[model samples]
Target: MTSQHEKNTGEFLGATHLEGCLFTGEWKPRTLTAPVMEPATGDQLALIALADPDQVAQSAQSASIIQKQWAATSPAARADILAKAVEVLAEQTSEVAQWLIREGGGAHMKANFEIAVTIKALRLAAALPEQAQGLVLPSVEGQTSFARRKPRGLIGIISPFNFPLYLAMRAVAPALALGNGVILKPDPRTAICGGHVIARIFELAGLPKGLLHVLPGGGEVGEALCSDPHIAMIQFTGSTGAGRAVGQLAGRHLKKVSLELGGKNPLIVLDDADIEAAAANAAWGAYLHQGQICMATGRILVHESIARAFTDRLAEKARAIKVGNPVSEEIFNGPLINQRQADHARSIVDETLSQGGILEAGGSGEGLFYQPTVLSGVRPGMRAFDEEVFGPVAVVTTFRTEDEAVTLANMTDYGLSASVFSKDIARAMRIGDCLHVGLLHINEQTVGDDVVNPFGGVGASGNGATIGGPANLDEFTEWQWVTQRDVPTAYPI
Candidate 1:
């Protein structure tokens, strides 16, 4: 039986058998299991299988075979199934929202937004079947020739803990829509909501069995997905360090790979900007999901003239946001996914403070809840400014000129997302052009996104591969050239 989450209570129960792997049209419960704990209370909610390499290969083989059959079906058939999946998922929005909060520590609004985006992504996938367009090419000697998009065989998708469902679907939906089989390796920490639930949704939507396999495993599982011969490509979303390893391993196997890595994004606040509005965006960008998002505003660059005003207003908002157990409280902020993450965030704050960074507000924490933190006078050469903290800590740095702001914004090796805030739209556009990132916004925060747009990054943030809209048609498939002739042409020889 598939695992089910108990609303209001942190319990994940399966019938007589607790299933972790969804393979070959069945939920298979394994022998060895790891606890899936609630981040808020450190309670063990359920147990998921720790998949081995052999099991991964078996699932990969199954998906590859099933994908061919699914791909052979008409494009209209694929679109209809995806459309059904969207409807099924929409009907169970409340259940998905609870899983988001309990498993990943997202607040209510964040949960709702995630649900909406996920549904939107599925709808986009529904359109991809018809949009996987082919081009007729001019052929020599009156021969008819064309290039068409074809599925890239089986695809290996490794999703992260934060925004588990959306990130997974960011790759999964497109792969399925484009007639590719999927071997999903969601982070073990969020297996149920991120992995099996996706399988369940598609199953309820009438997707053919075994086309998708939800295998929640650790590094070994990811390694198998990267190295397995059955998987044609690997789409990974996680830290740069981890992404590097995936890229390197997948490279050895001669497999196509997409790495959506870490980011140290920036938000430039000009003196002309409204202090309150800017502060709200900063708080949202830095503290939403406790800043666990890869696109979280890593640093804020402000015009030196209004540096103090921005910092003070930002600090006030930082302290104003309530942090608590997401399941039991009405709060904007929640736990840090696990004790280790909380400890790492705390250590970064301590190190930043000891390194001469001044704490404007929230330098304290208890257990997993680190208060929304703000550090001012934070400049280059400080941990808070240099590293990807991935916590609810906002680092404030001042720039003397527009050139300096651009320099500070592009200082990081990461180039995921950034934003420019100014009342003057022209100035905002000018500043935004100077920044190097995949997604840039004017008068908006760096944290937000719409799945309908092309999404990915450059340099350390991503390998230039994108997900969403027409881009997915390319990301999930390869090109094939077909030629036909009424009469046989003479051989060149």
Candidate 2:
């Protein structure tokens, strides 16, 4: 496998414009002192501006000022631009994948797949403006009433590092489609991948200068963006703790906020489940992207009858997964995004073992590589079993009954997503109905993502949805009610 610094025959894509900013319509790119680093190797990727909070404020101000004029542009015209952006994405899919690999710490294949999915999401969202519909209420007292969805001025998006392309574009596409100018604040770790690409595309599509500004910085920048009065809404994807902070800031500013927070999602395997299939599914759900996924099935609730068999199979698969540098096409598991994440993951596993949990198979490996680990005999109080393990670690616990499985599944504060493995359709339906997650999968793993589904979690996960989901498009817009009455008369006594 090639080290991060090793040069490839493919073209190198450098990070552009962090401080001075990129002017879209005017066609300009300026220098910034901020620098980007490759998380995998801690190598300097590019010098980005450590943009001041004032720059975030300036971005919101500029976007808000141009929002109305951009909103006035024909929706079809906006759609055309989005379509062009999608085309650009499709043409440069490989280039996008390389950036994702460097920044998000995913293998080349996974990054490429995410790029394709991002394009599909953008295309779906772009088609939405034409089909966006409003509701017409029944006339009350001879007055006609109807509602129209209007653009919500400026929106601030804060994306996570796990999904460099999908998460960022999911919000950007819908926000732009709804005629809202967006200010994107991506995770500093993977900012250059999605942040830089989207900014470049918007500029190439001739979008109004400042309509979609990319402010690539850290939490302080995000806090400023959320609190800025010029921003009407905030869309954030990050940890539960950070989401709470952003929520508080948005609340203080009286701005709408959509947050997709952390999860310790469960995978329930019933007694009647296909053991082989369930094992395979569990391995994919828990170890894909090294389990650095909000929806990754971190908790395994297997029926007592099959728990031993399932654990053995899962451990075998986990051990067999190839781990190496992200650029290697054959690598099934890549290093964690950085050393911090690896250490955190290791700490959680260590705590679990120290607390009497058994490490079933793989453990810690080379630099930034936490082995795909499965722990059995996990107690409820154990942090590894209860908390979100944002790495390749799985906790397996047995349940005597379906009720026990459901109870254990819903025990956490997160309700992002869950999955069940069973052959009986009726039982699957019943389990699905009782699952307290925002999304439930039957006879499959939980990492499945569809553009049309209303994808967002409930409970502490926050408000609103994303992708081309029906609800997501609406979240980007404002509701305007209209009432018309004939022969209206008013009298004062």
Candidate 3:
């Protein structure tokens, strides 16, 4: 009998070409190519051409040249094109979702959810023109002064492997909607869905040639794009180390950059909270997408009074999740992106146990699959508590007072997102306000996000620039001040 993963792989192979990169309005092969493998079965899916420094420079130059023409086009026309692109995305949802699952090693539900969220983001981006309102300032008599936003010539985007399509469009759709050209470099592991699929969709939607380009490659290509003179700004989503490198390089060039980096987010469960509901939410936040998300909750801070009950419920929930092939709808936790990640996750669990943390349930699995793990008695100095374990693992620690909970939650170098759960809404809101994170949720999970909300991080998480919502338009644009006078003024003596 054919397995569900095999069936999905066959459908993807039959539907799309396995090679080629998108240049300015053209599909072409490069001198160097790399093979992309299916993480679940370790099967070679396709070869993607790697863009070199020269190719990245060329693409950046093309985007700079094309941005002028794109900026001249009316905003309404651009919105229409984006709306059509959304329609095209809806039409190709199943194929693209399958590609995401095969390449990124995410479950079926996650793949479909990513597509739906991406489409919604594009729709929100379609309103950028109207949302980018200008201001008129008071001026001296006979003089008029006002300010409006203008497109930065070209933007370079570097997206990660997890949620490839959704993260890519978070920057791409808004840049295009704001009349700026973009050159995107997706992670080599997910080139098919992030580069090829997106390129094809925009082309079929009748977007002007040269306005959007997809270059699939490794770090060298991303470095080239960051340093390219033609590119005006950089928008990146990835690990903290990579983000630091990109941010430093962009800083030397005096170019604007936005980064959405890693997180060791915390979820606090008060004594008055519903134990079952809190456990379910914590499990979802920690184990969804196999805990690969930037905002995945790595620490669960529970009041000492309810810690045992909460930990028991969470452990039961974790044990119930089936870990296997992502293409199967019955499976909840799929394999990590690759073997190295699995080893890292395992090591973290091992270190936690060695450091006196007790494992409540699930500490091992086969191949790239690390079973969903629950740990208790985790302290601030433990590896699992301090570092980000980007796998299906959750660390639980007990806190006695609100001050202790807040302190324990803010103990890490990351401050990306945090969640507070309590029966008292007012108290939850108060605690949420005190948590030092870019995003906070009251009586909810940490993994949720909306397209219309400003979604980025603070401290080590990002550079304070917000993505999504109306703020995204600002990231891709600059302000131009205009002043007019009826009569020339004399120079001061």
Cα displacement (angstroms), candidate 3, residue 304, comes to 1.0
Question: Of the candidates shown, which would achieve the greatest lDDT relative to the real structure?
Answer: 3
Of 1 and 3, which scores higher on lDDT? 3
Clashes per prediction? 0, 5, 0
Model 3 Cα lDDT, one tens digit per residue, 1-493:
1354346545333223455434557676565888889999898777777888988888888778888999999989998989988998898888888788888999889989999999998888778766645789899999999998899889999999999998999899999999899998989889887777778778888889988988888889888988999989999999999999999998788889999999999999999999999999999999999999999988999999999999999999999999899876558888899888999999999999999999999999999988999999999899999999999998999999999999999897788999999999999998888888999998888997788888888889997647888678678889999999999888898
Q: Estimate each model's TM-score.
A: 0.96, 0.93, 0.96
Q: In model 3, which residue pairs have backbone atoms overlapping below 3 Å? A: none
RMSD in angstroms between candidate 1 and the native structure over all alpha carbons: 2.2
Candidate 1 lDDT trough over 10 residues, lowest sum: 9-18
lDDT measured at residue 282 in model 3 versus the true structure, 0 to 100:
97
Candidate 2: 10-residue stretch with minimal lDDT: 9-18
- Candidate 2, residue 40: Cα displacement in angstroms equals 3.3
Those runs of model 2 whose alpha carbons end farther than 4 Å from true positions after fitting are 1-32, 140-143, 464-468, 486-488
Total clashes for model 3: 0
* lDDT preference between candidates 1 and 2, better one: 1
Kindly report which residue stretches of model 1 are placed more than 4 angstroms away from their true locations once superposed.
Answer: 1-24
Identify the runs in model 3 with alpha carbons over 4 angstroms from their true place: 1-17
Winner on TM-score (1 vs 2): 1
Model 2 / residue 122 / CA error / Å: 0.8
